[model samples]
Target: MKRRIAREKAVQILFQLDVAEVQLPDAIDMVMEDSTGESTEFLLSLVHGTLENLPAIDAEIQKYLRNWKLDRIANVDRSVLRLAFYELMFDEATPDRVVLNEAVELAKLFSDEQSYKFINGVLSAYLQAGATTTES
Candidate 1:
């Protein structure tokens, strides 16, 4: 089974980073400490690595977002995209489908009903196109 709770906690921490303007590393420390699970390390890795690669991740998001700018995306949807994109792009340990599915689920939990379909469409298009990036 998935460590859904840990993923949920990471999603919350990511949300805090945007709304609360909390430093990413500090948010990771707080979230990692509070989140209990065998998957804590994986969750922490996702948060930190995604934060580290946020610029590139956002670039990818922008490529797929069509008319919307990155900043225009809801904070919850943006964070969910960052997490899922990080996993899909960098974390070979996580399957692409799992990353996309978990992101959709998280978006549904944190965002409006429209968020689920939006995230699903973006991630699906991303996957279908093989997630090629011009960035290093």
Candidate 2:
């Protein structure tokens, strides 16, 4: 599957894990059940890495949130941030700009009408905080 599609599925699987109280493998399996493909390594790393590093990711997200609590944000929005943060903070192969762009796109594709801005704002703040370079 394309990375975009994998990201969409990652958001869904993360949503399940966050809301439905599903295990990591079960969340991944549920999302992949309908997908027809061979390469899932990217998707697997996303969900697994997100879950594995959830505490740190959530903490980073909390730093960006103004008044909104992590749990209080829309599920889809939260999922998008988690997935994006994993790439932004953990995955070095993908550029930080790409991660930021992908995050906004994910929010636009899945969340509420205004969620894209919210996602963009949060991720942009993360970048500005000097987490890392966005240079490719």
Candidate 3:
């Protein structure tokens, strides 16, 4: 699957995981129920990698938040942030620019109208602040 599509699916799966308290595999299955193919490897990796590295990702995000706790962010916005950070942190082949853009796009599509701006702000600040990843 294309990275954008895979990323979108990752957000969906992650949202289910967060909101429904669903297990990773089950959340993935629920999100992929409409797919013609089984979950693509890229999709699986994004979801798995994000979840595997979640504690680290959330901690990193907390550093960038001003007044808002991570949990207080809208669920879809949180999912987009996590997926994009997963790509930024671990998927080195994709540039941070692409990750940021895709994240904003996903937020626009799945989150409330104002959410994309918030997503963009946090990500841009993180990048400008010299974002570090586990792999870095």
TM-scores, each model vs. reference:
0.85, 0.92, 0.93
Worst 10 residues of 2 by lDDT: 127-136
* Residue range 29-113, candidate 3, lDDT tens digits: 7777888665498988888889889998998888888899999999999999998888888888888898999999999899877
| lDDT, model 1, position 49 | 84
Q: What lDDT tens digits, residue by residue, belong to model 1 across residues 29-102?
A: 77667445555666677678888898888888888887788899898898888888888887777788888889
RMSD of 3: 1.5
lDDT of 3 at 111: 83
TM match of model 1 to true structure: 0.85
| Candidates ranked by TM-score | 3, 2, 1
The candidate, 2 or 3, that scores higher on lDDT is: 2
lDDT of each: 0.81, 0.88, 0.86
Q: Give the range where candidate 1 is weakest over 10 consecutive residues by summed lDDT.
A: 34-43
Q: Which stretches of candidate 2 lie over 4 Å from their true place?
A: 133-136
Residue 131's lDDT within candidate 2 is: 86
Candidate 3, pairs of clashing residues: none
